[model samples]
Target: MSGSETIGSYLNRLAAGRPTPGGGATGALQAAQGAALLGMAARFTTGEGYEDQADRMERIASRSEEIIRRALKVSDDDQEAFAAVAESYKLPGETADEEADRSEAIQRALLGAVEPPRELTRIAAEVIEMCAEIVGVVNPNVLSDVAAAAESARAAASTAIVTLEINIRAVDDEGTRDELRRDVERGEVAVATAATVTRRVRDDLAR
Candidate 1:
């Protein structure tokens, strides 16, 4: 990871024959972009005599950046978890008695696959909430960028929820599947709430 590494380059490398930096990494990148936009709004607002709101904007900017960094790290974690799951699937099971071992391995792998996107949805929702809070307060000149951040956050949340649901569907354990289904439902509600907030903020800025 060079300091000059553009996101496109990073994503290209991840998408290459490498197993890491899959959907989780891509979702993180989307969240990072949103964070960057929020930071931009903060910077603009802080500079243009909006000193009264600077502290709040600064907090939002910091939180957004932290979320982006965490999301990026989670991408690597997701890849590593997936690799571990793959290794588990390959565990020696030559005997009929190994059935339990195989089942355990499969369960672990399913859990690994479910975790990354679950984290993604949570982070995306956080970013959205931050964006909503800062939307109308930021420099009006940068309202479009704020909107972009909100939209990107919403997209990331939606994508993450879908990924989680797909992984959940692949799990063999009914209990785990049901738990994941509930998570999916919660994610849907969060995304809808975020979308509504984004829309209201955009409308307020328009006014």
Candidate 2:
């Protein structure tokens, strides 16, 4: 899985009987798309008399691009981790002692699947916050694009949190489950905040 692989190719592989590149990967891709839209809005606003926010937009644009790149990489990581888990599941465990081995394998796989999406949720929340700040500041001509970015970020956050929840439910460790649940709650708060901010910005602009 080279970074050079196009999204279409990546998604095709994900859909092609592969266990990795599941919901976590899709959530990361959604976050990346949102980040890209944020960068686009920032770039469009940089010139054209939007000077007050030019420096901020430039910073946001750069950060957004970097975050998107990182997010895309995480998508690949999710796929790889999932594959590793699936492979572990195939290991033979015929003896009573092997029961422990199987449990360990399942736990490892569940952890692998959980961590990437948890990170995805955090990063998606950051992207959402950045978009919320820029929503009204960007070029009015590209307001819709800004809104789209915000919406994407919201969706990504929501999806990532859901993935986290699903994975947490599979974990036998109560402590780990509690921690993941808290993280998901935080991500949900961020998503809600971003949505409120975006909606206000959009409504104000319409009026």
Best by TM-score: 2
User: What TM-score, over all chains together, does every model reach?
Assistant: 0.82, 0.91
Cα deviation at 156, candidate 1, in Å, is: 1.7
Q: Give lDDT for model 2.
A: 0.82
lDDT of 1: 0.76
TM-score of 2: 0.91
lDDT of 2 at 19: 69
Give me the runs in candidate 2 sitting further than 4 Å from their true place: none
Q: Write the per-residue lDDT of candidate 2 for residues 184-204, one digit (tens) a residue.
A: 997898788777767876797
Task: Give one digit per residue, the lDDT tens place, for model 1 in 166-205.
Answer: 7776788888788777777766875786677677766876
Q: How close is candidate 1 to the true structure, as a TM-score?
A: 0.82
Model number with the top lDDT: 2
Instruction: Report, for every candidate in turn, its global Cα lDDT versus the true structure.
Output: 0.76, 0.82
